[model samples]
Target: MGRAFVYVILGGGVAAGYAALEFTRKGVSPGELCIISEEPVAPYERPALSKGFLLPESPARLPSFHTCVGANEERLTPKWYKEHGIELVLGTRVKSVDVRRKKLLTATGETISYKILLIATGARALKLEEFGVDGSEAENVCYLRDLADANGLVNVMQSCSSGNAVVIGGGYIGMECAASLAINKINVTLVFPEVHCMARLFTPKIASYYEEYYQSKGVKFVKGTVLTSFEFDSSGKVMAVNLRDGSQLPADLVVVGIGIRPNTSLFEGQLTLEKGGIKVNGKMQTSNDSVYAVGDVAAFPVKLFGETRRLEHVDSARKSAKHAVAAIMEPKKSGEFDYLPFFYSRVFGLSWQFYGDNVGEAVHFGDYSSGTFGAYWISKGHLVGSFLEGGTKEEYEAIAKATSLKPPVEDLAELGQQGLNFALTISKKPQPALPIEVSRSTSGLVLEKPVYAWHAAAGLVLTASIAGFAYWYGRRRRRW
Candidate 1:
């Protein structure tokens, strides 16, 4: 009976790990399900290592859940899959996939036949040298992706004294690394080619708030500048960064948090790619019939943005894994994963929470000077995105409600508690003027005090209902 079936899972990220669990629960006997992981170590939490693990000031370690064992470790690590009779081929790379033959060629010169295959090969960080930044002194410059990278950065941080550390790119990872270094009182200078941080994802207003937050934490920013070249000291360590402009930055430690690239060369002409990312529909299935991709590799669709953008967020990976599993099990009945992109980052003492994809213009609802407030993004007369800085549950709920619906445009002249009420109501009558753009014209404006929690809970439930309805509709469509 066991010989009648065999399923192979390639890649070792969250998608591969969890999808294996899903297969087991469906009564696929252990011998029938095989997981081949490229990484020698079992899967562990990746995000914590970069922020909490590297920071000496932080008491954070790997989470107790899903503990992984390294290959060298001789603890006879209790294998959850082994107990269930599942086979785990560790430290093995899938050299090639013969999809037509249902075969996987491994680096160890072994041929494994699979009745079904799931490709969760994920991505790797694009090396700085790949971007044409050549220097033998990349020894001091570090990139964060895995636990090894985090541990290496920790060592680099300890070896260097309080000198200037230059960070290239102002994306989420870059900003987080800068904040982590600053928490240890290390002088950090961040440079981004864009005028503002996270320009590709956030509005100018929300990016400004982040800029102010980083500045308040003593991080110096060199906006609108790109790294043109890297200079090294006599000791083979990076010492300076030349900018696209006629300026250069002195550096002791340089951290590159630019972005990540999907590892897709293994499936090179076999899969469809969008701008170099693997293109997958809502079900997380690749162009091929039996192959499905998830995590950083999958170019999934975002309903709010009306685009199939690839997201690298942790929650996105989790959701996409489930979607991929469903597609594999019930391809004829599997539903798509539709989740609003949610992200949270802590810089200094402030927690910035962003919900939904930021695709529209921003609307500021609170004061920015006090280092606390929230902003909403309205897209085509509907709430599409929001960011709350040092926000309360109620503020988050309001933003949740804003994103959950296509509420009519609000009158800027009538904003506040009354304005929120007015926003809830749709206006059939033609507006007196086409939507006007209102930016934060003033730098300093004393705002009113915070509202009660009752206001937030009410808004949260309403938004939850809308989400529930959408999920129900998607599931219903899958059944049909």
Candidate 2:
């Protein structure tokens, strides 16, 4: 048998949830939209899987961390979808897709047709087996990705209480999971081939601060080494991990988070691919006019950086999904999507936020010992990126605004001396307001002129006219 929908969203992820919300907001009728996902439950914030969900006490659960809530919007729970009359085809995988026919063949021998489609398959976490090291199937060897993975990790954590735990990789998952394991009273030994953790983003100087903090928390670091093999016990549980440096560490539990690969295998020949992801336009539309892509699987153009990038962060997924929906529903009103890259993390009592591209000369500021420090990246005499820790809400906003504006820097020394003040001053300056547009009615009467003004101090926009004035607040774009 076959089913049909006016719009269909593939891959139940952050993008899919946000797309569903946007579609409903744009006045989608009941039964007109459907979301097909291999996940058994509705979409929840994926970032939470690495952070709050792993807490030792009262960990975050479903419905609490569902979609839209991450953006401070209404939470889209399973009930919410039902109330909206939106169908959620959970635990169902699309075996094949026919873009020309706008049909999807489910794994269970069902054909689903749609007029328009959104692809948000996201990515899958890389396993140690891919690196040629076996024992990934061991009961205690865990890799966090979905709800099932998180639940498995939690069970392993509980079973290995106060035991030695080995965390592989130095990326977001490794660092966050290590912190969680340490908090759970487990001896955490984080091993990675890089000289330091978060090698892709944090510089040596920035990494030093976190390394010191983690050390103080009893988390050991084994840098410049890779796992060559795993030693398992009679019960098929990982007991130790052998490293490339000719070293072996006792491991009652193993958590691997090397990296992720975009889920683009399904559309390899059917769609244009770039940067290891499906190619899409500013509107998130793929090469096929009726199909679109978003999340980690879509390599859309980055206007600020002037290049196509496949961002594997949740913020891009959410914004791109909403933009795609807007473009589909209100093609005449929707403009090109403009996004500023953002990333953040929280471990123990520490939290930090990074905005814009990280390139060019780096300037360090603040005191590291006191737990307040930040850095600015200057490229071509303009501030291109800003990173801050232990910053106030307004200070974070100032840095984000300055990074987006790309304020000119005359001297590196002066910029360092000025520190956060520079961003604050730049943020204080007023932005050019959009010119008021006026139109005439068919009766030759002048219609009310609409004034579009930016409120810099509040980071909001005011749309005023003879009829009324409405304030539109901007949301902070953040990724895990």
Candidate 3:
């Protein structure tokens, strides 16, 4: 006989933690929910691995930077789970899942049955060996994906005498780890095939600004090229990296941040897949009604883009998980998941955030030479995307709100000059002529004067009671 659960979350990542927290808040019976994870710990702040965890001094550890805390909510420590009567099956790997049987078979031969399963398997780091290199298997080569990886890197950093590292890929992992390595007194060399760091998000001009800053910090950038192979010593440790540009770099340590591939192989043929992930409806439900997917493994509808995307960011994971749990708990009241893509990274004292699709012509704004600056991407004459560095809280909010409206930019040159001012102005009111085409139903302005439930309240109520409800409801779920 197999153990049973009303809700089972697979994979212990941000999505799983958020989902668990939501389930408890939304009300769940004791013993009805369980979370199975390969990692010993519960869901954590995954982004910290490359940031606080790598800091040479007093790095972040467990219980402090856990999930829910990132969202300013209560942190879900192990005791919290136990108090909520939510069983946690940690450090256990599920070898296979039978959607038809609604059963998950563990590697240890334990069969767990679930009435509803939320697959939050997340993703795995792309290994260098996949690109025809043997360096990934060599000692001193680290990949940042989980707590273990971060801990191993920390240990290697402390033990290394050469104080030199070669970082592969110029994406998030590479940029962040390089900063940490530099802080640890390691001479770092970044190798990537892109023309600039963060090529996917930053334009050459923007990239150059950060690259120059990195150069000042003793960080070396080897762009427009890739690692061909690794030079290994007799001890099977990576000694140097061979590049396609006919160059070699002596490395005491190697960190590969090439990319990641979603962990969807387990459900490849069992479930419908799209956009490199398990296809899920607006409710995050898979083809099998009983099975749903969230986080990186889910190819969910991006309401802003009008397409399905497997967003590999912590914000998306948190939002999608909560929305999925809501749909399950209150199917009647739950609507389609409406989300805007958000991505940000902080490295070497520089922080930047981006909202919406980065398409069409990018108009550089502000002073790119130093300090605060950004760019606005005008696609189809609409201000579809916004980026900012060293922005105030209000400024960041302005860009996010303005970008969400998809305001029209009639003159690219004028918009560029206006920059953050234009976004701030448009976010406050409807700019009909300036590409603001928000549906009347979704506007926050609609509820500003009302005091009832914005989504469900009909007609206006007459007092403090209604106003308080509206304020509380709106504030509690402003982002959702």
* C-alpha RMSD between model 3 and the true structure: 9.1
Which of the two candidates, 1 or 2, achieves a greater TM-score against the reference?
2
Looking at model 1, the pairs that clash are 30-85
Better of 1 and 3 by TM-score: 3
Regions of candidate 1 where Cα sits further than 4 Å from its true position: 1-5, 62-78, 331-333, 369-371, 393-398, 410-480
lDDT of 3 by residue, 1-480 (tens): 579999999999999999999998889899999999999998898999999999888999998877878888899999999999999999999999999999999999999999999999999999877888876766699999999999999988887844789999898999999998998889999999999999989989899998998899999999989998888889999888899989999998999999899998878789999988899999999999999999999999876666678888999999999999999888898999988889998988989999988888999899866669999988766777899999999999999998887776799889988989998998898543422233322311111122335523443444667899889999889868
lDDT of 1 by residue, 1-480 (tens): 112237777877666666766675566765787778876765555666656775666545544323222112222222676787777787888788777777778888888888777777777876767878776246778888876687778878887767778888898778888988887778999998898898777677778777877888889999887787888777878889898887988987889888788888877877788756788888877888777777777887765555688887766776777677777777787776666777777666777777775655666666668767666666555566667777666655566555544354565434433433333342222433433322221322111233456667877999999999999999999999
TM-score of each: 0.78, 0.90, 0.89
lDDT of 2 at 105: 98
Model 3 whole-model lDDT (C-alpha atoms): 0.88
Name the regions of candidate 2 deviating beyond 4 angstroms.
433-480
lDDT of each: 0.70, 0.89, 0.88
Error of 3 at 361 (Å): 0.9
Question: How far is 18's C-alpha from truth in model 1 (Å)?
Answer: 3.1
Question: Predictions ranked by lDDT, top down?
Answer: 2, 3, 1
Please identify which of the two predictions, 1 or 3, would achieve the higher lDDT against the true structure. 3
